[model samples]
Target: MSATLNPNIFRAYDIRGVAERDLTTESVVPIANSFAAMLVDAGSRDVALGRDVRASSPRIAEVFRQALSSAGLQVYDLGIVSTPMLYYGVSRFQRGGGVMITASHNPSPDNGLKLLINDVAISGDRIQEIYQGAQAGRKIVADGGAVHTTDILDTYVTELTEQACIGPRALKIAVDGGNGMSGPSITRLLDRLGIEHIDLYCDPDGDFPNHHPDPTQIDTLVDLQRTVLEHGCDLGLAFDGDGDRIGVVDEEGRVIHGDRLVIIYAREILKEVPGARIVGEVKCSDTLFSMIEKWGGDPIMSRVGHSFIKATLRENGALLAGEMSGHMFFKHRYYGFDDAVYAAMRLLEIASNVPEDAPFSTLLADVPDTVTTPEIRVDCPDISKFGVVDSVVSHFRALRPVEDIDGARIRFENGWGLVRASNTQPVLVLRFEATTDAELNAYQSEIMEVVTAAISACDDSV
Candidate 1:
């Protein structure tokens, strides 16, 4: 184990870095050893491991599993599974914890891990604790634990089929897996659901030769939209590299952003669980909150991270929580983990009940929408991102009404804008949602002005 390993790999929510530069075998082995040692210290004897289609994922998982086994921890290998499947394995099989080898929506040259302790996400202080444990060389290595392989795909598919109440309807759909981990499970689930669909780039090709696995980027979804339109399919769906988040296109080949999807899902959830609590991140549309309220559900706002959303969900017993990035968590009748396949199935189920003419777009047609900017990322060094956010917060506090949920969210008369530091990247995230294009432009301009001033201050302070 080298003492020169970069501790920045252990980030706030997950372990992520460029594959060769930061996530090499040398660093990963020790990090896995450290992670296994943490589990052992917490009385965990068995763990589950899964990975996406990234080229680095297999080797990484193998090394990680070996590290866990070396620490006397049993490792159940779920070869080539989605992140949610890893979570499912941990919760369903009662494993001590789970590790998913994926960079999520990152570029192909990057890969990392999302770790769970006893089926719960380990973040915030716990992440620091893990890094500290690794730094201190505090690890337990015994001879009892072993590694084994399991095929849980059938079980995963069956559970999803039960959750999906898609009544019989002859509908054509197109799904683009982006050459990621969602293909296998998605194909299996759709088969069980008796759906007739076309699969584009369904193979688990780590090279991501088709496009980047991130469906949130409109460019990545171009093929999906084309397929849907050419085939005259009812809808088009795409999943990120790990299959935890999703992006969708309606029949008219229009992208339905995640916030609108949340609005659609909330309407359905409110029917079954009236007055139930729903959560949305600061990046989500204010229309979501108002719509949720109109549908008789209480809408709560939260920070823009999975750990934060999951914690808020558990605390409030929220039926659902959604992020603008297409991460949807449903606790209405399923686990709270973000599962894109499950979400797609739920969408299909909802679509089944609507009239043939009433497409998924109809749900959002009535919701008041403003010219919202897609999430904008500005490059800022990791060390300076938080300081920039702090300065922006201070500036906004003095300028106008602001909400300090996870960042500085400035409220305007007809809209709102947010400037927050990204938890997963060296960037500042900005979003503007307004009642009109003019207001949205104004909001975006005003907030960016504050952010620009703040960035200047950050540079001066540095």
Candidate 2:
């Protein structure tokens, strides 16, 4: 029963890797056993568990349940639910902890676990500890912890509807679930809110037959844009594989970036709660931070990742926090966890109040324009990405002022360039923003030179 676990799968945010290679049923049992032991050691008697519709999910969930029960921890299995719902269930039921069997936008061939301890998303050193325990072949053998099957979809939909503010505008929306986990929850929530919507790829198919579930990639949103335009809908919304992140399109079939979405959401929320603190990831546009301040609310920059941002939100008592990758967390009227379906509903509520003559783009007309790069993901070996980041950080620190908040964000006079290791993928994430095209190019060139040099040095050393 002692399978060698891949330490790389124990990522900064969650556990993820190729299902066939890193997440075999045998390997998953040890992980689950370690998780259950962690909960039991912390005095948690019960756990709320859920999974996505991936092919490996059922087997993984069953093995996990067995492990939990074996560790003397009751398991409330919410079969085939989204990541957000898993978080909601744990927080709602006041359970000791929860585990979501999902990879959240990773490809169909991949699967992973999103862990929660005491209602907080677990990450960093805690995740490392789990890996260490599993490697040590640690097992907690106990007796008499029962497993119960439960459905929280209806309850989740009802709760979100109660807290949502649906505008009186009878708007038409087109939603593409990308054969991920968003369809059922979003459709139900929209139905309860009395809004008209068209569903595309709403059925949860683990194969992801229509397209990859990651809407942040422009190509993935093509079908959604076509659907919105063809249906003449007022908006189009797309969700990742686990429904925790969202990608949106305006009425004119234009994909809206996360920073722009923040502007719209913050404008509405600030009107109601003036001076409320709002947070955006370090990768977000500078305009977003400045605009939040202009709107009379404090803007706090945070490290990317839902777990990190959620912790920051609570620490600052911020009502809202978002990332450029589409993870939007709202604490205004809902839980602090990132929930895309709820965010889409909130977007609709905001759009309904806009004048008929204006478009969603108009809502952000006042924001200053700047040249920025779409998240540039440079592929690196999982073993080397972190080293690459560290090397780059060291190289840049001697040249310009660098902010190592999450990564090295080298600030220049006109703009800033970021180089960081992606927590979820084996890639070095890079982004740059500048006041003009020339300044943007200069900043990008300077950072690219350092990154290339560091990567080469890393490879040479290896």
Off by over 4 Å in 2: none
Which pairs of residues clash in candidate 1, taking residues 3 or more apart in a chain or in different chains?
none
| Alpha-carbon lDDT, every model | 0.87, 0.89
Tens digits of per-residue lDDT for model 2 on 395-418? 889988988998898889978999
| Worst 10-residue lDDT window, candidate 1 | 1-10
The digit string of per-residue lDDT tens for model 1 on 95-175 reads 999999999888889998899889888988888777777667666779988889998999999998987788656667999
Candidate 2 weakest lDDT stretch, 10 residues = 356-365
Model 1 segments more than 4 A misplaced: none
